[model samples]
Target: MKEYSVVPNKDVTGWMVKIEDVAPEKLYDERDAAIAEAEEIAQKNKPSRVIIMDQNHEVEEERTY
Candidate 1:
């Protein structure tokens, strides 16, 4: 399974979804590039909403009941 990490702008007023992932050097670089590209596209389009989806992989440690 593949996972993506996303970071949205701080303002939260625009439609931009940045997606990234942990991987080899080349793939990581590509992911960064992809995020920049997506930001540009969202800025131009100005959609009503922007959503970022990432795979759930991390396991949450259980607390004592």
Candidate 2:
């Protein structure tokens, strides 16, 4: 399974979801939907930006022998 990152716009009106392995073929439509949803959830307390880090980016610690 691949990890994804969801970052909201600076205006706090929408969010951007990105995945390393999966590139969105069309982001215009998706962006609209995501924005609408975020706005609804955020309501009055909208977030300036939402950043979702990809779990895949997490690196495992290596032990030196």
Candidate 2, 62: how far from true, in Å?
22
* Candidate 2: tens digits of C-alpha lDDT, residues 1-65: 23333444455444455443255312323444644443443343333332232224332221111
RMSD for all candidates, in order, please. Answer: 13.9, 13.2
Instruction: Give model 1's clash tally.
Output: 0
Model 1: residues with Cα > 4 Å off, grouped in runs: 1-29, 48-65
Against the hidden true structure, what lDDT does model 2 obtain?
0.37
Residue range 1-65, candidate 1, lDDT tens digits = 12223332334223233323333222223334644544454455544222343333232221111
